[model samples]
Target: MRTLILTALLATTTALAATAQDASNTLDRGNWQDAASLGASLDSADGYTIAAKATTLGASVSPDSAKAALLKKAQSYANQAIKLNPNSASAYFELARADGRLAQYTGILESLGLAGEIKKALVKAIDLDPKFDEAYVALGLWNAELAAKGGGASFITGARGDQVIPNFEKAIAIAPTTIAHRLEYANSLLLLNRNSNRSAAIAQLQKAVSLTPVTYWDKQDLAAAQKKLDALR
Candidate 1:
């Protein structure tokens, strides 16, 4: 009986690993929808987390009209991941990303409501994994966007302008060669205080443009970085 039980457990583990590998292969092939679908079908926290990430990545390239739906789907997957594994830092990070993207399509009050959720999720993700560079980038953007809104937005969201650059700098320090990290940092610098951060922003953009893109999303970010740098110069 013990031998049979051990064999069954090994089979289950192998199956789970196979599913994870297939999902990763689909992602590497740039089949975002397929990867998301495959991930959703798996019965594991890691699977749901990958599904959330794939859906979020798809939303980034989707039409504005379709983005909200994709983000919503990603949010659901992230929630499932967190439910299954509360300690998953990537799951919380994905939840934060989905909420941040959805905020773009919402009213001011609604967006502010989401800002709190985004901050909470990001903080949890960072607490779980201190090396989560993407969370820092999103946190920086959160600060920059709210501070840029001025008026009551910053005060209501508790977003301090002082936190923006430092968060981005932390992300860059953690992932110096990541194109998206540099591009986002440059963009957030401009958003926070363009005139004051113009030179620093330009340098980051230049670095982003110089980096080699390894994926479709990276290529898109690299192009954006180049365009922004050209405009700045």
Candidate 2:
């Protein structure tokens, strides 16, 4: 009886290991479709993470008319990832990103509520992974946006102007070459729209404009950064 039980446990462990390896292999595929097929293959943490990344990519480039569908897909994948691995900080970040983008498409009241969610999820991500530099960018942008909205909006949104610059600076310190972090920081600075801050925003944009594109979104954002720099001049 003892031998039989040991054999059964070993078999189960081997099978689980194989499954995990397969999932990791599927996730390594460059194409989003490949990741989607594997991630949507029953319940799997890696599957969910890859699927969420693909969906977020879609959301990033999609037009306003199509963004909703992409964000919804991202939300589904992110939720699945969280369900499979509740401690997944990256999953939570993707979920927060989907909500933030969705809020942009919706009304102001709904947007504020989503902003609150963004704040919460970003904090959770940072708590889970102290080196979550990407989360810091989003959180800084949140503070900057609310700060730009004036006293009434600040009161409603519970965002602090004091936190904006530091969070963004931390993200840059953590990942200096990350084009998205630089762009986001510049954007938040421009949101201030004060004559004093415009030069600082321009400086950040110039740095981003000089970097080589590392991803598809990087290409799009670099173009925008150049345009913004031109406008600033």
Candidate 3:
């Protein structure tokens, strides 16, 4: 009787395994490309997902061989998204981001022109979608980095600090939950306050360290900011 029971249990387990394998195979056979194409045709979230995945993969991959393939794929998806919906500011912004990442990987001077073009495209994106916080964030960073001599201090000051602070503040106002936006804003404030407001700069760096996420880059940046604040102290 015991032997018969063991035999039955083994058969049942084998049957269940076979059934699970069949289900897995069936799921694997589903046509993702067709589904994605349909989503693209209908202007659905799946299309955005595809583009976002491509962009993320492009950014995550190495700069060496076969990595360029991922970037090319990202470019293709971004272009497809833009083609599918010309009115989508997010699509253009994502395309610009992908291009910027690629430019960064491939010598800044070599791609400076492309970066400038992407910057211009982002401006158009903001004009099209004024409420887009990501676009504002990108514009703020670009302006901070590309600003003329003296860290664009003269230009930003002449503009009543609105040109820099307002853009970063707007991004923070729109997306209070995003730590990146806050960190970027704080970094910009630190630069702006270097000569005029050392105490304010230290405060901003402290806030940046406090608000940043616990990722590697965030932790590193937070540490650096804290170190600077300590030096000021």
Which is the leading candidate under TM-score? 1
Estimate every model's Cα lDDT from 0 to 1: 0.92, 0.80, 0.59
lDDT of 1 by residue, 13-86 (tens): 99999998899778766789999999999968889998998999899888899999999999999999999999
Residue 67 lDDT in candidate 3: 55
**Candidate closer to the true structure by lDDT (higher is better), 1 or 2:** 1
User: Residues 1-233, candidate 3, lDDT per residue (tens digit)?
Assistant: 99999999999778655653443233234433333343334343336534443443434534466555555556666677777777778777777776666665676454555656667668878888998897887777666544422534334323234467678778878876555565566556655556665666566666766774544434545666677667877
2 or 3, which is superior by TM-score?
Answer: 2
Collision count for each candidate, in order:
0, 0, 0
The candidate that wins on lDDT is 1
RMSD versus native structure for model 3: 12.5
Candidate numbers sorted by TM-score from highest down = 1, 2, 3
Candidate 2 regions with alpha-carbon error over 4 angstroms: 1-34
Predicted candidate 2 versus true structure: per-residue lDDT over 1-233, tens digit per residue? 99999999999878756765564455444345555666666466666766776666666666778888877887888888888898999888888888877877888788887888888888888999888998999889889888897887789879988888999988989988888888888889878775878889889998999898765566777888888889988
Could you give me the TM-score of model 2 versus the true structure?
0.83
The true-versus-predicted C-alpha distance at residue 143 of model 3, in Å, is 0.9
